[model samples]
Target: MKLTSVSKSLRKLRIPAVLFRRLAVAALPLLLLLALATGCSLFERGGSSAISHKIDQEEDVISSNGGVISNLDKLDSFMERGSGSQRIVQYTIEGDPIFIETRYEGGRLELSYDTTEDAFGPREVKTYSCDKLVRTEEKHQLKYSLKGCGEDMGDGDLLTVDFDLGRQDKFEFILKYGFNHRNEINTVNQNLVKDMLDGTVIEISDYGLPVEDRQSIYRKLVLSNYLGEKQLSTSCNLKPYQSYDLTVLINSAERHYAWSECDTGRDGKVMTEAAEYIIGLVEAGDSFLQLPAATGSVK
Candidate 1:
């Protein structure tokens, strides 16, 4: 073949020198070193072009999985401590004012609202607005949380609207109070029952609350949906002394302790009323006493 023919044939068989040099410049230093050390096919057939193709494939995979290289720092920060704050503005029905202060604490967010009313007052209301943080696929961003009654309130959240028991049927539950004779004085039960005269036995007897009344009381519990207008935490448990048993049954079967509810700050006015009502019934009737079990711990 003529020299011109041979030159053209060689050009077609090999990558141009400029293109090969560009590939070497574009490849990452570590990858270039690896390709060179291994004498791999990376550069055999337009090696730089092969590297570019591999990079494009990787990028496609990342994009499909909702990954963004720019957000690596943000992703690392999520596993670390994160914090934010939100504010709620409320206006009373009479155009009076109230405010809710929210802050992130521990592992969850806390919200507090004032539930007090003034003399001759129709209460005001405030609505909350904030960017709710959420993770979407691979990124975190603020989502607009709903604003209005019965929305955006997490469990343990108390709104002023919950405080009203107007015409609402009372909750029905049974309570038992027993005297603890043990000497352990530092315990919660001991402190709560200290005022009770020694040997005063409290028990539950034949109690009958209409099913509707029972449902109403159960609904008033925080574990139920209505968290009255406000919730206040106080150490109000009534523990029997060590080795003493006090049993409280809700809905006629679910077992509980009076002091357990008080210590946990879960008791409210309705619960207090129910306890008193149960006491009145016990004073008038006789029921079996549930003696302390072998388990010595006060619930």
Candidate 2:
């Protein structure tokens, strides 16, 4: 039963004023100790039903075992003390799974959600820093107030791409592309290119792209509806002579959207277009052109 329900029952008993005062005094320390043992403030924001259901399941198991606990419940309880530095609260908001995790060691709070598009996809993570957290009960619901907190990251402000290309001639290349809110574009390339005199050489390069080019790439991707595209399933046939793999990640306030196609029988037209555009832009640089062509078959 909830603590509030127990308090209501005690009030209805109409005990003598003096006895009730003494009982309250005696219970204060126990309540404080219970709160400390659980490593959670009594006003922490979370769904009571979810917590109650978990407790009920544990109780059922204990009863089935004749009140003997063979399996210890790791969940925070008065008897099973928890680490006070970290706390995690999980609940659903309008059918979407939401997780709010806080770490007191660094005074950081992370809010994440499982988007409807992909339940198992990477969750979007947003972080904040504050000295304390406050919560209030409203209409039987607990609401958290993150006052004096500073946000560290925002939604749709970070974009990243992973592109892999393999040719029929046993040549492969991988590109890691990053774009930050500051309009910075960075690319890291790892390629096994076929050099005319060297046969094949491993070339690793890291450089920043022009901001103007970054804007162009970002616009093209947005226009192509890149974030809205879903990953296509691969076929069970033998590996193709030439194949492409692409994964694009966009971080948002709610969740991270990851669109990936890995070694599918055929490359997705939209994703391929975006990958090619980025490659073309990179190769346009004089230094990049010095490296053997990452695409096309060996002569």
Candidate 3:
């Protein structure tokens, strides 16, 4: 009986020991797995998002208020602190005018017109004259840019005219804006385009446009048809381009155009033709090549 009681007590103690071992074996792996999962979560969320968000936020802040870039030096310093590609564009609106003197009416009639450009100012008078053959009523209405250019800039900003000295001559797409001329903040986009096309060094004014727009202008002007066969010329003889920002459409007239309309409709045909012409010129040029900035600090 004493031996039996001893054996029973041993069995009870053995049951508790086995239960403890079972509990430890099941719980250890779960604890290890939880520890590993916690570490993975922390790694997945480390400073990456904060850093990205901070940069993105700063870019947004600058872009939203790009119009008032009063301090060029401070802007230069900010660029010095960053890595990767950075661009700063600067252009001044000198009140210079653009003049387009061309042969229109199938190169039969000669026309000369002075279109005024001063962005911060307005004009009610525009002058047009046909120096060649004329028979019918002379239409003297100064042409404003028909392109969708009036969105940010106002009307009469860009001038266009179709006159018939005898055979319906047209002087279209004339640019006369320069340091002596002034253009609104908007049409200067085309000036940047042309400069890029001609390989001239225009300190781009990231003053109002984003990087994408600047690059888009580069692509368009670099490969545009409107500028094809068109030389970036200074108005040498008749009158200088004064009181404007930059002159575009200096060679040919721009037809009423819309990009979306062209891929699916009619209006883009003129723009396409112009772009095609410009592209042809690009192929034949010692003119413009993209000057990707020196890979270093902005300063």
Candidate 4:
């Protein structure tokens, strides 16, 4: 019998519409078997092709719009489309602003959360072996434990610092707080000076500190109680005239601490001491100075 006639008879039987639709889908394979046995055709010659074409059209729509595969069931298919090379898949969980991103590159998978709510927040990344990821996907169990995946690093570790000295000066300091104990400092339109007596711009870069010097800085930071806690107690005022932004990542605990202030108080004093100590180490002298100071006269 034609599929339409069968549907009409099922409707006459008053079967619940939902149940009837489900039953129809469930019986498709059985009907096909019967049709083959009876030497009959359940669909016209190109019916299956039309259904495949429609599915392809839907997939095209998804691919055009960021290729976000919300349905977990389709994740394998989505990955297949990447042709086993570098690909980035981004998806949101329950419409959250934070996107869960998966990066496939060099036969490894890295998962991270992408968001701007806390731009300086610590980053948590989980890496998985490509073979393990594939096996987990096949088992329909994609939830992996985050513990021991990898250590989360703070943005401060890389010296991702930003200073906004309004109407004072426009310059940049490229600093790298390397993990290998080999740090670097580069400036633009600026210079480091040994002292006011030596008013000469000290051009320096790729400065590597000795172990003792590095330890001295760390001891000062710890003594000031800056690295003792995750959050430091301090009062910050917004001057809108000048601001200092700094983030520090403690490698020992993999913790991140941020300080943003327009005027100095407790936190400011501590940070200043730490900064000067670092500068001293960089200059390898008793005192250090920055020409064309970033601070301006307060209104």
Best by TM-score: 2
Instruction: Report RMSD (Å) for each prediction in the order shown.
Output: 21.3, 19.6, 27.8, 19.2
Full-model lDDT for every candidate: 0.34, 0.39, 0.31, 0.39
Per-candidate TM-score against the hidden true structure: 0.22, 0.29, 0.17, 0.25
Model 4, 94-186: lDDT tens per residue?
332333344455644454443432234332333343322431311111232222233352221100111112221222333333122122343
Model 1: per-residue Cα lDDT over 1-299, one tens digit each: 12343345546768688875565456446565675677653333521211111222111211111111111223224324456543333445554334444445664544444333322343333333332333222111212232222356533322222222233433333233433332211111312112124434232223344344344443334222122122433343455432222232322233343332343333344444444443443333222123332333344
Rank the candidate models, highest TM-score first: 2, 4, 1, 3
lDDT of 3 by residue, 1-299 (tens): 12243345556666687765675567556655765766433123322211111222122212112122222222234334432222222222553332323233332322233222434434122223232222222243223222222244222322222222233232223222322322122333423223222224343332244433333433343223332332232233323322221224322444222232113222234344444443344323332244343333211
Q: In candidate 2, what residue range of length 10 has the lowest lDDT sum? A: 63-72
Candidate 2, 53-103: lDDT as tens digits: 222222221211111121112222311222233223232323333333444
* Backbone steric clashes in candidate 3, count: 47
TM-score of 2: 0.29
Model 1: residues with Cα > 4 Å off, grouped in runs:
1-145, 148-171, 177-196, 201-220, 223-253, 257-299
Ordered by lDDT, highest first, the candidates read 4, 2, 1, 3
